[model samples]
Target: MIQNSKLFIAAAATLVAAVVLNPTPEQHRARIKEAIAERSPLAGFLGVGALTAFASTYHPLGLASYTTVNDHTVSIGVLGMVFVLQPSKDT
Candidate 1:
């Protein structure tokens, strides 16, 4: 558990550093997509699908909060999955 926590912290720090370096929009998108792809494609798909489903369930007024929360969850899942899967450089 301690090792896992340290690993998570390290990964989060690396991601933060990468973003702070102000990568181009395309680079950001590609990095994020690559991370997501590193995880099981199905997992990434499901994460986004779940967020969309949640957003769809709510009315417009209620949707903002739902979308915000769901988006954060999905993003974290994608990032974590990417870190865990550790895709190859070519990927």
Candidate 2:
């Protein structure tokens, strides 16, 4: 329960920060393109497929806060693993 609360808080903070920063549309598109461009062809295909499957799971929940919190944890876990595996550019 505590961990889930922490994840929710962190996500809230991130959303607040984004709103405060108000990134330009071009900046947002550039960032999105950079992210998509980094993925291999096979990985990108599977990622889109998996995301579609995940979206299909949302019908029952219908945009509940708890469901969002659960999804955030999955994203946080994936990002945690990626950060752990990747070395810092300054190294």
> How many pairs collide in each candidate, listed in order?
0, 0
lDDT of each: 0.39, 0.35
Clashing pairs in 1: none
Range of the 10 consecutive residues with the lowest summed lDDT in candidate 1: 58-67
Segments of candidate 2 deviating more than 4 angstroms? 24-91
- Model 1 stretches with alpha carbons more than 4 Å out: 1-21, 43-91
Model 2 TM: 0.26
The candidate scoring highest on lDDT is 1
Q: List the residue pairs that clash in candidate 2.
A: none
Model 1 Cα lDDT, one tens digit per residue, 1-91:
9999999999988767544543232333344445554555885666753333334321122112111233232222222121112324653
